[model samples]
Target chain A: MAELLRTHPLEAWAAALAELPDEVRITPEPFVAMVDVRVPAAASEGLAVRGTPLPTAPNTWTPTADGRMVWLGPDEWLLTSTGTVPHLLEEELRDQLRPVGGTAVDVSAQRIGLRISGTRAREVLAKGCSIDLHPRAFPAGRSAQTTLGQAGVVLLSLGEEGFAVLVRSSFAGYLASWLLDAGLEYVPLG
Target chain B: MQLIACPWCGPREEVEFTYGGQAHVPYPDDPAALSDEQWAHYVFFRDNTKGRFAERWNHSAGCRRWFNAVRDTTSYRFQRVYRVDDPKPVTP
Candidate 1:
């Protein structure tokens, strides 16, 4: 008898997805997640450790060695990390950039990262999202926040045939189930 | 599938923007002193021109910044995009 790890709705989906048919494979990419932190306006200086200030907006972006951190709004930014969540880096951000009158909320547990890669990646994604994921429209390195099957999602174009989707943890199971059903049309790589 | 050049987010599809009505409407400094007609003008008056018009649009889905643009309403061609603080000069 193996000890079971406590799981949330999304975590359960991730586990169940692993047992998917051999043809339909679900690969869970490691580390990348969305951290929602609220910074107060008074202590808002030095948020962007690098990169130039946005021309018309009050935000900026700092490209990391492997990925980039994009300012989503006032006191909010999406830090793209590789492999594992940078706990020390996040702590540094909280200590260094705590808003004067705002608090930072760690919403990392509320989101899930799903990487859909393979020749049929685009075909699988198009079944849910309406955005033109064509290379001409959404080239590699580009990202957009849009609705996937009417579900809020952050879609990142990782490569010619690779994509990363960030969906709310609550909707992860539904999304994963939808993907598995739609992926049946393609030659599953799992 | 119209392409809109967001002053902050660069060129994106018009679907990413939310039309924010006319631009350059100054708020009344003294609302109590103004007449009813003046108040109505400030609240409802707008220049809905058909030719080249300066309008306000917020990149709601992108950078979420509001900027001004001179676009031809007839042809849907964007001639110039400028920051909100920049003066909207008359174009020939």
Candidate 2:
């Protein structure tokens, strides 16, 4: 299973980091991540899980006991785990929900989750996206799907100065490479 | 810019949606019995109300769902947003 899992080039790049220059600062903030879970429409059991009908169109965000769930589309949701996400929950969701309709493809391993924080995080995002990221408009705990440098991305504002970008697994290498090149001018924090 | 409230996604930028024209325009139950002029009226004629009007809009960018809203044609302010199957008051 370890060999089957694809290696992200950025992982190697991060592993290679050593001493830093006096003027340039770099730090690592790990454990921030994302996972793609696909459940077929049938599995929803006419519940309209994402945006079909049961829940009605225009997917809504409802608070749950554990965390918040954002309906991405029909039969799809992006679940934000409050703390560490256990594999058991994923397995349970599959067992309970998968039988009603389509297969659940766990693409959690496909994408990379990067946490960009600090005073200049918004400035870094502005270089790529067009939407207003100001606190008045975006605020914390808001997530939206939009284009970032020609790449479709899910932008989530986690804090006043923190954000998470969920990029496709295949594009992770390119996005990380691009961010590194662009972030060179900033106080680089990993 | 007209402010159109999506029934599902709530109010969003007009750029994220597509105007779907007037709502509540149902097809004639018996099209075979209607005259050509009546058929034309049913197909092409639109009320084009100057005041509060019910219209359809699709959240093209966000939820990709179609819903109904009551919007003022003059000020372009959306009065109310509701699902398609929900009952709406008839303008006498």
Candidate 3:
């Protein structure tokens, strides 16, 4: 068995999201787990780490049959998948990346993943985010890391009008409040 | 918020990036050999250009990486955005 060294990053915010407006909900995504990987784009070709290639195109993400790969920088990517053996996975990824002078390590606990989806989710996100959320510009499969509520966050389009807002655990509470406040105008009185 | 173009992430709101002060300031190759005054100059003083200036910015909210930008101080318009490794684009 591989040794583990991480705790759930979003545990503190789980209960808080449950109380968000029913019309525009902020739900803690299931802990799928994450790892940050880095490799030069030239060397990443034909190299599939955990069945996902390192994405080089800026602000884009690639989906695998089992997981997803997000391009972080010219040489950085974040790999995410569901697994209990973080140590083993990180070790294997590191070994594979070594030949190309790249590395992979765990960052699952560094961020909290939030799924903000509802009829009014887009409206709420537009309040604090500058990116044009219109379907044509940020279609599904597109991803961008930008400041939301003055906190750094990676915004990924999940589907039509639905989004995945990823933020460091420390900023989860602040972003959630911002989103809730932005959505207040739309929530029906109950 | 103003829009800042990132070489990688395209244009994002300014709040997503952190101002890294004056750019083109390199660390001394041998810090231990520098005199006290020289050290102080390197650490404390930076050109506050009134016109066009070169500076570093970290796309903290986007790519989470640092890069350089040349902008007109008076107009607050970015003249260029380039990678850290690339030569600083000439400022006019």
- For model 3 the local lDDT of residue A1 reads 27
Going through the candidates in order, their DockQ values are: 0.21, 0.17, 0.73
lDDT of 1 at A80: 55
True-vs-predicted CA distance for residue A114, candidate 1, Å: 1.9
What's the TM for model 2? 0.54
Residue A136 in model 3: lDDT: 91
Tens digit of per-residue lDDT, candidate 1, span A53-125: 2111333344465455555655555665453344644665567455344344445566677877766677778
When only chain A is evaluated, what TM-score does every model earn?
Answer: 0.67, 0.63, 0.86
Candidate 2 residue B59 Cα shift, in angstroms, is 1.6
lDDT string, candidate 2, A71-93, tens digits = 56655666544343435446555
CA lDDT of every candidate: 0.66, 0.59, 0.80
lDDT of 3 by residue, A69-90 (tens): 8878888888877654666668
Instruction: Judging by TM-score against the true structure, name the best candidate.
Output: 3
What's model 3's lDDT at B47? Answer: 92
Candidate 3 per-residue lDDT over residues B61-82, each given as its tens digit:
6788899999889999988999
Q: Which stretches of candidate 2 lie over 4 Å from their true place?
A: A1-69, A73-75, A79-95, A98-114, A123-141, A146-152, A167-190, B1-3, B27-45, B89-92
Give DockQ: model 3. Answer: 0.73
TM-score of 3: 0.85
Q: Per-prediction fnat values?
A: 0.30, 0.22, 1.00
- Interface RMSD per candidate (angstroms): 4.5, 3.6, 1.2
What TM-score, to 2 decimal places, does chain A of model 2 have? 0.63
